[model samples]
Target: MRSEKEMMDLVLSLAEQDERIRIVTLEGSRANINIPKKNDLEFMEEVLIDDNMVFDIDNLKGFLNDTSSFGFIAKENNKIIGFAYCYTLLRPDGKTMFYLHSIGMLPNYQDKGYGSKLLSFIKEYSKEIGCSEMFLITDKGNPRACHVYEKLGGKNDYKDEIVYVYDYEKGDK
Candidate 1:
């Protein structure tokens, strides 16, 4: 098997090169501030790449196949450290847009600008595809992610419950 770091680099580089990949987001318990317990497969399966952690692939695939999704894991050396996943939706106007479903860096990788690098790639991709805008939903609970988005020039467009809609126009990226 390839090293985890190698795998992460591959995923990010591929996303950087492909315009069809409009955005990269993350999902699952990893987005939760509370690190998940290892005993359950449900939470584990929600993550795209668990590294040495065991998860139910069949369950995860089933859940994702029902939607338009793309995911990537970040690695350093041979170890997996972070991930992002995005879900696409068709608007009533017949325009296609994608949401930044989830994004997370492993505890050790946080605040190191890796997330920005990934987001930059995603934004550039969205522009190349002629997308009008890109959106992301984050919680007031996850202020760190919000801060990151703001630093990247994201605008707050809407919010309901804990979900905050961070939007970027096509020309800005």
Candidate 2:
């Protein structure tokens, strides 16, 4: 397994070299009262666990039923290297936007620039599917990821908003 630093390095390198990647932005913030002080790694671990439990076959079937929902994986020699989950929807004004829910590379593939490849694919695929913009969240303490987003020309103008989340199966709090 590759260290987090190595994965970060590759993500940054790809952002630097890729012209298709635009608008990289951090998602998690210090003001997020739900998650106090978890760093990127910790946040990712929690997300990984949640995804495993949430993306069961039945859930995926429902997700697939929604035309705006999409998921993709990066593979090399038939081996999975990375994955992305996203949802694109049309607003009341007829504008289309997508939320990049997750993007992650396997530890062993982190340094190989596969994350960038996966992101690139997401951009093109989103465009192909009629999306105009995409957004994602990253932890505030994850400077490495923030740097990559900045390098990719992502803007971070949002500030001071509380994130409210409710899992469908877990029911409302």
Candidate 3:
């Protein structure tokens, strides 16, 4: 565990390097994870402990039966190393795109060329399927992901785009 000051310094260093991080501390806002303020980590743990999980096997079965989405797994000597989930999207222009998500690789395989190769394969597969575009969330904070996407000719048309997420069905008071 790092001291709060050390952690702050590290965050400052990263913010300096990332243009997406416009403001640093002494701008004086308390983050949820900040040492002096709310502990979202503990909150997350408590939520995990308190919430009862119920899996809908029928829903999963229906999804498995549905088309228009697929996953690509990268394997080496019969061992799966990486995977990317993609869903087909039909645009108003009558062209299709692949909405890529849930891309992941084993920790030992990460930072290797396998991730690049897997992504490249996905692109090629998308092209083969007549997809006009591929869309995926590549946050600039993830410099490694950005680097890989850039090498693959991915474009960022909008800088500093704000994303809004709506979480469903949590009883709020």
All models: lDDT?
A: 0.55, 0.55, 0.56
* The best candidate in terms of TM-score: 3
TM-score of each: 0.57, 0.62, 0.63
Q: lDDT tens string, model 2, 2-38?
A: 5655543443344334333222221222110111111
lDDT of each residue in 66-115, candidate 1, tens digit only: 54665554444434456666666778888778677777776777887767
- Cα RMSD, each candidate: 12.4, 13.7, 18.1
Give one digit per residue, the lDDT tens place, for model 3 in 1-173: 66544544443444344322221111112211112122222322222223332323333234334567554545554344555557888999999998886566667778877777777767776797799999888676899988888888989888878776665666433
> Between the candidate structures 1 and 3, which one is better when assessed by lDDT?
3
Could you give the candidate ranking by TM-score, starting with the highest?
A: 3, 2, 1
Give residue 55's lDDT in candidate 3 (0 to 100): 29
Off by over 4 Å in 1: 1-54, 63-67, 159-173
Instruction: Give RMSD (Å) of candidate 2 vs. truth.
Output: 13.7
Kindly report which residue pairs in candidate 2 clash with one another: 23-154, 24-154, 27-137, 27-138
Whole-structure CA lDDT of model 3: 0.56
For model 3, name the residue pairs that clash: none
Model 3: residues >4 Å from true position, as ranges? 1-57, 169-173
